[model samples]
Target: MYAVIKTGGKQYRVIAGQKLKIEQIAADIGQQITLNEVLAVGSGEGLVVGTPLVSGASVVAKVVSQGRHDKVRIFKMRRRKHYQKRQGHRQNYTEIQVETVNA
Candidate 1:
């Protein structure tokens, strides 16, 4: 079975035993977290979509690691004014292993 879940303003399609990196969550490594915002669940036969979220449905996951992604460079310049700016950012993320989708 597979599930569609929302986290950090993004949606992800996931299945049991899948590992995915998502926006940072305040949980320690090795901790188990339940992703309660399940939008849909699907099996071999059909799919069930929720209005917002499916009641009594959840995806259980284990926090595998927490880290930042590669830096993203930003640069801006104005031709006449000779104004320039540069910046770099690394977005934090959490890696989790999906354990089960209970629906």
Candidate 2:
């Protein structure tokens, strides 16, 4: 089975034993985290979507690692002004292993 869950202001599709990177979370490696905002659940039969979220449904996962994403370059320039600005940013992220989805 698979589940749609919300965390760190984002939604992710996860299945048992799956690993995924998401926006940063305040947890250490190997820590257990339960995704409470389960949006939907799916099986070989079909899928069940919720109105906002499914009640009494959740997904459990373990923190695998924490790190930053590759740097993104931002450049800006003005025509004929001989002015330019350049910047780079790396977003933080967390890697989690989906343990199970309970619906």
lDDT of each: 0.97, 0.93
* TM-scores, all models, native as reference: 0.97, 0.94
lDDT of 1 by residue, 1-103 (tens): 9999999999999999999999999999999999999999999888999998988899999999999999999999999998999999999999999999999
lDDT of predicted model 2: 0.93
Q: List, in order, the clash count of every candidate structure.
A: 0, 0
Best by lDDT: 1
By TM-score, who's the top model here? 1
Worst 10 residues of 2 by lDDT: 5-14
Clashing pairs in 1: none
Model 2 TM-score, 2 decimals: 0.94
**RMSD vs true structure, all candidates:** 0.7, 1.0
Error of 2 at 25 (Å): 0.8
